[model samples]
Target chain A: MKTVWTQKGFLIPAGALLIAILLPIFASEYALHIAVLVLLYAYLSTAWNVLGGYAGQHSLGHSLFLGIGAYTSTFLFTKIGLTPWVGMWIGALLAGLVGWFVGYLCFRYGLKGPYFALVTIAIAEAMVSLTNNINFIGGAMGLEVKWLGNSPLLMQFESKAGYYYIALVMLVIALWLVYWLSRQRFGYHLIAVRENEDAAEALGVDTLRVKIQASILSAFLTALGGTFFAQYFTYINPRNVFGEGPSIQILLFAIVGGLGTVWGPAVGALVLVPIAELARGWLGGSFAGAHLLLYGTVMVLVMLFMPKGIIGLYESIRQRLKRGSSAPEEERTPA
Target chain B: MSMLTVSNLSRYFGGLAAVVDMSFTVEKGEIVGLIGPNGAGKTTVFNMLSGFIPPTSGEIIYQGRRMNGLKPHQICELGVTRTFQVVQPFPDMTVLENTMIGAYVRHPNTTDAKRKALETLERVDLDAKADKLGRDLTLLELKRLEIGKALASEPDLLLLDEAAAGLKDTEIEDILTLIRQLNREGMTLLIVEHLMKVIMNLSHRIIVLDFGKMIAEGTPQEISQHPAVLEAYLGKDE
Candidate 1:
């Protein structure tokens, strides 16, 4: 009596979404806002997973795309009187182009391993420096959208529910993309390159082209999230967009969830984001930076105790249970 | 007609001449065995030929095209492929996927690549382990997977570096039979092996190297009784 829904294994996600939608009804307004932030990070983490997880390219500079996305949309709306909805695609395209260029330079020069990670960090830092000196979009002071009216057309919402729904849609899209990528031929090539470049090349895979494509796709999706974040918050700053904290948070979600698995980052965000908000709410102003300290400590603990990640730990336990149940039954009727 | 021609190929590491003044021609659709003692620069010769390492001074003409300074992938695209002495299948990939990547060169489409990969796996009799990961395979399976990968590339010239090393006698026989079958199917093969019996059974002609110099070149039967070949292998103990 296997059900179609259960057979597909989509029941978990379906159930989870149902719970998420129903939670805002019983929860406080503050809790809803926290949930929105969690969904946003989860979406971004999943996007990063395309390059960092599937491709095995550790990029510490993903915040560069986020910053570019936020800046592009906000700049377009404030300068040309365009709505953010129209600006989103523009931002995504720009981010993807920039990502391709950066990836090309890194891959062409054979900058790999930790050196590649360092290059990403350098690019992010350089972007921050460049933005600081460039006064085109309010420079170091940051940009704020001053609106006469809170209009849905402007992508400015009066309630947190609108942001929640949007973030939910993004998360769903990111998860689907990750799922599709994991089963695709390009996805297999990325994994092969990740596992062993020499072996992949010997087998006729063009490693550089595959990696660059991964990077471009990751950047485009990440930038879309950035546009949404700017429109939802109605404020954008270089520090907030391209900051080290945002970079760490995205990586932490992916790493804490499961580095290479599709659902790992989403699971990580669901578990960690609310805890972070709760810690901040409980600690208050006197305990400033305590949430960060706690987050860092938990990340370190997760890495040390469960190196394969929370999802990996869950898989190991599941396998053990399966073996235990099946083995005992087989022993009872030994040949 | 020669498919591959090497002339005045030389490589030096500081003061040591690894491969010096070497020249050879591998005729189309022929098996040429390169036999040499340890450190006689046999692997280095293969490396230079396959574009893994550049020769300090040399010319390599493959399929009547200059192949002196091309990358390994480019050389592969030009219908030349080689297997490493150390088996290098992507350990995380299944045996079928490992071969599929090789087949991808000719058939970039997924369906076509998988179909060709299946055919190559069947030829090597590794179709049963198609779903098994490379890391989980036995030593013989790994070696077979390596050959399957090279075969997947659809190469005109296949360079096999010590394909029979570290194998049991029966395993070696299986590989020899597969090589003979491939040769009969019109594939050109250049094999490097230390095993006398396998080389004698497979090679149409043998070239022996000692101290980075060609000591003998003849048919397997002729080389077997050559005093220089015997002296090179046994150090004149006879």
Candidate 2:
């Protein structure tokens, strides 16, 4: 059973990755654009999963960190003439600091569950309002990256495929990080805290420190995604990057794909983003927010049928198959 | 040398004392039991000692160091850790994974932590359940798995909150035997339990509580015969 699981785990992700790699080669420009977008969302959702999914702290304000990353890089490039690559790191560090403060305060004060979620939402809104008034970051007018015509250092690419590969690499890196974390003692400690905080305390897992670290890592990764987003679109606005919409979208992908699983966000992005994009393309403004209606209906069905998300559905079927195949062994064992 | 010293420890939950002016000293390698009726604050005392709650006033000196305001993980780092009365296993993780978290208190590396966890599970006779998810374990296995996890931290002074609670006689004896083996290996234990037989047999000395106050402290024979203990705790049986 264990071998089969291990084999399946490796084989499935490898198979999916092989397909994702070849997609850009045969795809039309529009399809390639959508693929890049899917990879972008995958990066965001996967980064969000570090805290929101594994640590079990649902933050609807991750966009605050996203905006922080976008603005920091955009300003560094436009005003200071530094490469976006360097600016990206600086933005990530700043986001990490902010996430640390937020996590420390929330965990220290015992804000959890829905209360924590609400605070995140409020923070995102506050960032949106703050960015609108900050004249240094171009204020409400937003910042536009000048087309440098295929400079690798600028992160401004000529083709959608360049952005696609970058986004794909970033997504893969985020997945690898989450995967590494899930196998660590630190990861188990997070799960322990998630399962029962009091129990985790007695058993000697430093609940506060672990949570704060998770928040910091989460912010750092999300910021990288934000940099990717800014580079891909070549434009940044407070309302677009730092809005509540991004948070909801990220959360929907993680929750619907599978909370607490490394592959859940990737799978979620693959399933949800394509469907919504295609739905939007098909509906074509005949009925406004029709894609959201599709999302709403799909999410409700997912919640109803698989509360543990899509992964739970896959798990149960595997269990049933194993149970069915084990009848002979069970009889032989005198059960 | 004393493994732990609790001097004038008191905990008040908004004007109600849960453990009032409690003082106790546990010697190295001794199994000490805290016994009381329900709501006598046994768990409260355990909580304060393990750093789950800060004492309203007093000291928790472990291994010659002041641990009064230290957090639980810091105290565990100092070789003091605990198990809960209400068993809490990370439901999503396997038994080995659960134990690995405790082991990680000392060994941060994944390979070392897993080896330590597996050793602890073997010692607790829970190696067979290593890969089983926590929620799938039966009641007896769950309790054993709880002990397995606690032991993985390699604590010098272990606090067990009602380890023998809700067990049949045979299962209780199995746990008691395990505790005895652990104690013989030089691990000091401070257990809170209501079961008379298990506590009497496993503990070298027992402290009895009534209404958040220590009524008696003696050998099992003396505690059973103490007038206050009989009147306040065991008396209810009559």
Candidate 3:
């Protein structure tokens, strides 16, 4: 309520938005593809941050929602001859329901911290193996999304620009959603539960409800990203889309950016995605998996500089600047 | 009239009895004190009353509703909330934000909850430190923050678990004043403390527990003079 958006805050985001909107218009195909990937990961990371960061519930099964989104919309479009735009929403709904069920069982049984993380990992892993064996769901062969050539109605496009813009829009929407949530009562409940469950509960917070709601909302958004990925890439597979790799990758974006902060994941995506892609390109044939080494090194360096992530580092610097220029430190830092 | 009724409450951690047959009633507007030595099941009793832990073989009735099987949040919503014996603050949050979390229980709007939280913070003299993160607060500040957060829930029966355990004498006096002020405003409190002087001055009635069982129950003067109470605190002479 105390005016979270300062003039500088408004200016920075507005400037960033202008750049993001205009970047696709004049970009080359390869650059646009990278931009699309960056936006896509930004979207997924934002989704994961809702629960993993804000609610303090680390979930490694987010790829399940992603696969569900991609699979459901793809199935509906291929089988029922429906447009993907509508199917995407249905996929989101189904994922939300599944997320709620999973969250309910976990919170109801009081699964917390590492145990909860394991359950999520186990669920995603099971989905991976199950999708591989299920014949109707394309089994290990995977599913290909058929594009009828440049149709806006189908949410498919011949130009990478379209996907880039769409992914950018998704990223923007996800960031706004997190910003809106952080300023709401429900958001406070999620953060409280995250900070200390017992204290939150004693103070009249419904920790279970907060966790469940966060899980569902997060899944819904992540699944929407999945649908977008399927539409953008024109293909989906259990091993690639629902694998532990995607789940971990998405979380890393949030973690590296600053887990609890609204724009942290988006910032993370913007900064890390391009660096990783460039590293991969530069290290293409000289050595296998060398790009990952560079990626890991960058992450380590960033963490060494700012242990809480980029957003945290920014906040601390800003705080110190304020204290330095305007006033004295109010009290000594706690020991 | 009884605001809280604990009948035959007992809690066992595996084979060890932490609270044994603890039965007491807190009146609607009195400050009731629970005092015992360390590990005397004081915190266990507080946990049961606040619905953090269930009583093994008893019932907790709060304002005509059963509270034994209820969750802590549910009990809080039923107008009973408590502070922890060991101070627990939401370290990442600002003082106002930490208090706002409790205020959110009643006021479902962010703006409204913040306003309520601010009012509660002011009550506990923490308004000046509202912008500071919980982790930045000093020890005494954290203790006040613990109480401030609990008070934000607007509970009819406030359970204070060792409210003045780690405070200096002057700091304890500040807490006593706050408790008195809250009681004067018609708030009922059930406090747990180790210090005799603090508890004797604040509580309308004092209950003593030893080995998870009630050793004495009376007014401050009476309880201070009770033989069983003396035996519990100082070993009985042969």
Candidate 4:
């Protein structure tokens, strides 16, 4: 019985991967642009899930790391003629260091729940203020990637297809990383820390260390999204990357999709992003505020009815169906 | 040889001294009972010993190594594990997974940890409900699962706080029997229990405390007869 469930679990994701890989083939250019937007949000949210979802540390200021990544790569590319491919790693490392610092400072003092969330917001807000006044990295004006036509090396391309494929590949890798995390010892320790800290400590989990590591990994992954954002859009400013708006948007997908599940954030982005795009495209001037209204309504309905998100709703239905199918067989064989 | 030696252990929460100048020693293999009236600091002692709270001034020597500066996980790695008075199970996880978190301390590999956790569940008589979520268990089952989780680390010494608290006669008896079976298998224990029957029946020696101070220490029979203990504990119990 367990083996059958396991086989189905593996096969479904494999089938979905195949479908996602072929989606671009039949998609219109405009549709593919929307697909890229979905993948980008999915990638960012999945990155946020390492700490915010699995470890239960809701960092409301994750845009701090995103901004760091964007500024780091953009500065390096514009100043030294360095490629973004190399600068991205350097940005990731810096973001990881900042993540470690922030995690240690907050967790060491036992800041948690709402206090931890507030600290992240404060730190991200501080970064935005600092960036606005700084003379380097284009200051308030922002940096635009030099558009050397069809130059893949500089992370600049002539078409949206190039950016779309890059975003797709990045999302796939992030998904694979999260999938691997769900099965490992570190993952279990992380979940344990989230469930109950004192109990996890009694059971020999170093909750502080686990939280720090998750923070660093989450920050590292989020920074990659930052670099991708700068490269794909060809422009990045303080408000676009480090602002409270994008920060909320990043966590929104994770919470609405289902917090802590491997594919839930991706699932959230897939459902919400396209609706947003299609709503705006179809309704344009006729319904100026229609998409926002629709989006807000869906969020409220999910929170009210499906508090555990869509994946949780699906899981309950699946369990009921399995039990329904197996009930009669058990009675006939034993009684 | 002493497995644990605590001297002058004290904890002050602001102006209030929760535990004061308390000292005790547990030999290599013995079940020691800690009994006291409410607010007598039994849980506070356990908290300090497990490294959850830093002692204001004291020394905790476990197997001849000073444990003052160690973290909770560090203490656990040294083969001393504890269970909370308030049963804490990872509510989202299954009983087996809850035990697996403890098993992961010694067995870093997932498959090996799962195997150990399964064995622990069987020992605690919870194998039948191993797949049930932690929050779904009855109070008796939750207590047993708590013990199973602590036992999964294969600790040389275990500290149990109120393991049999708030239970029926049969449920307490079931827990008492499980503790006895574990001790017979060579697990040493330092248990803080409220039930007189549980402490007096199982302890080789008993320590009695009142208002954060130890009033008596001796064999269970001697402790039951001590005048200070009588006034401090039995008076409060009645």
In the range A186-273, model 3's lDDT, one tens digit per residue, is 8888888999999999988889999999999999999999999999889898988899989988998998999889989988998999
Q: For residues B1-238, what per-residue lDDT tens digits would candidate 3 score against the true structure?
A: 4778889999999999999988899889999999988889999998988878888899888887888788999888888889998899999999999999889878989899999999999988899999999999999999999999999989889999888888899999899999999999999999998888899999999999999999889999999889998888889879
Q: For model 3, report DockQ.
A: 0.90
2 versus 3: better DockQ goes to: 3
On residues A139-228, what C-alpha lDDT tens digit does candidate 4 reach at each position? 888888887788999888877788888898999899899988888889988899999998899889999999999999999999988998
- Cα displacement (angstroms), candidate 3, residue B127, comes to 1.0
- The weakest ten consecutive residues by lDDT in model 2 chain A span A1-10
Model 2 bad stretches (over 4 Å): A1-8, B234-238
Number of the candidate with higher lDDT, 3 or 4: 4
Per-candidate total of colliding backbone pairs: 0, 0, 0, 0
Give the C-alpha miss distance for residue A272 in model 3, angstroms: 1.0
Worst 10 residues of 3 chain A by lDDT: A326-335
Task: Give the best candidate by DockQ.
Answer: 3
- lDDT per model, in order? 0.87, 0.88, 0.90, 0.91
TM-score of every candidate = 0.90, 0.96, 0.97, 0.96
Q: Model 1 segments beyond 4 Å from truth?
A: A1-6, A18-27, A284-286, A317-335, B13-16, B122-125, B236-238
